[model samples]
Target: MEWLETRELRYFTAVAEELHFGRAAERLGMAQPPLSRAVQRLERRLGVALLDRGRHGVALTPAGAVLLDEARATLDAAAAAARRTRRAVEPGGRLVLAVKANGAHDLLRALLDAYAREPDAAEVEVVLCGIGEDERMLRDGRADAALLHPLYSSLAGFDSEEVLTEEQVVVLPAGHPLAARTSLTLAEVADVPGLPAARWPLRDGGYPPGPGPEVRDLSQLAQLIALGRTSTVIPASARAWLWTAHSAVPLVDAPSVTTHIAWPPQSRSRPLAALVRTAVGLGRQA
Candidate 1:
């Protein structure tokens, strides 16, 4: 009894209840031989006949039935103890959050608020990751989790949730001819005097800079747009956060941006899990 592990109890209970070694192993996610060995070990330690073997089925003896009941209670108690320890560590634990520019919205803001207010989880670690490198960082465990586009959903070994959905807005140059118009369409900007529909340093595609201008980042793109460079199209939230001093109009006929929280399935960090819990809260809030 002292030397028998809880796993042995679990294995015995599974076989006792199922009355079948193969089915018990399948449920326990282990090979049949290993499960049979565990049951044999348990019976040996207790010095009792636990199961009556049969060609077509297995049945627990009376002693096995009593042991099965006790085993389940012991495992439940063990599980509760584990949860308490996890909660203790959750307080002020570290979390590595990976995010792209697209997911910076009210939902993310709310998630921050939740984490900041959680009782067992208030401390956090945030990382700014780009969409281009999102999958690698998550799959390789370089980052705990990330905010990504819908495309990242295709990446295996990870889970995701749509936390935010913001519509696209038309970012126009200040004092531009089309800026006076209430709204514009994609077809209207297709041949408009700027760069192609999509360009670097200009994610929103609302207002971009010169084609050869070497717009290294959004900061430069915004500066150029302020100086009446090419226009860009950006999500509405980005418009509020980054469209300062720039003329912005909603797209008359463009689709909205769907923001999702993506994370590797294998990570077991408590704080990282808290962030995901916060993401679920955000999803509910959405």
Candidate 2:
């Protein structure tokens, strides 16, 4: 088979995701017939049936499901290549760093300040992202680097250096009995009466099965904790920002959270290297 065009992959991906050619066509800003033909051509070239059309609806065959995943990755890589190429040729290059909002706490401030002191440090632009968003930003070239936690962020495709490792702590209402404890185990906090653990949105923007209130950010979670409606576990450093109405107890058995400065494995930017060095040095000091 000859090389497959990105256009064909994109068309097929949209159709596979939506399972409705008309909707996918509308999304692609093209007519349904052409989009349908494109997908058909792609299927013919691959010599396989991608979609099963019936009176009821459209569905993906086994091969179609596999292609959807690969096609999405390929599209993202192509886009990233284009974006990075443009950024490289700009008059004054800058490095964009993605960090989860309310994450990295005091360490972020220190990293930025220390890097700025470097003689020729490229201007570092910080992009504050939502939960589990730093990885996506890095993958799509929206960010040059990211400060991510190993527990919640995937580092499969990136080279990372550990910046800080700290124990986890459970945040609860100041008035709650558990708040008075010096340290609590995970089991002790799991089923707190009237204070179920807060549920955070997943990458798909859906909350995991839970009875607790759904929270999108730390600010909302903090408010819920203060109101005695919900509780959550977070890195120990986060305690520095808790409201007066909130109290934190270290989780004895909870896993330690490690913050890493991560960048694409193929990154060869000098500025990014210098920034990583600064972060590593600061981590050693701490």
Candidate No. with top lDDT: 2
Worst 10 residues of 2 by lDDT: 84-93
Tens digit of lDDT per residue, candidate 1, span 1-286?
2676888888887888788888999999999998888788778878999999977678878898888888886776566446434644554655556665544656667788887776656465666554355544554445557777663334444687777777777677767787778888888875677533335533333435535355445666677777776667777777645555577777868887777777655456666677777887777766
Worst 10 residues of 1 by lDDT: 196-205
Q: lDDT per residue, candidate 2, 75-175, as tens digits?
A: 99999878877887766579899998867679999999999998758888999887898999999988889999978889988899999999999999999
- Give residue 23's error in model 2 in angstroms: 3.4
Q: State model 1's lDDT.
A: 0.68
Can you give the lDDT of residue 31 in candidate 1?
97
After the best TM-score superposition of candidate 2, give how far the Cα of residue 286 lies from its true spot, in angstroms: 2.6
Pick the TM-score winner. 2
Residue 58 of model 1: what lDDT?
85
Runs of candidate 1 with Cα error greater than 4 angstroms are 1-92, 151-156, 194-198, 201-214
lDDT of each: 0.68, 0.91
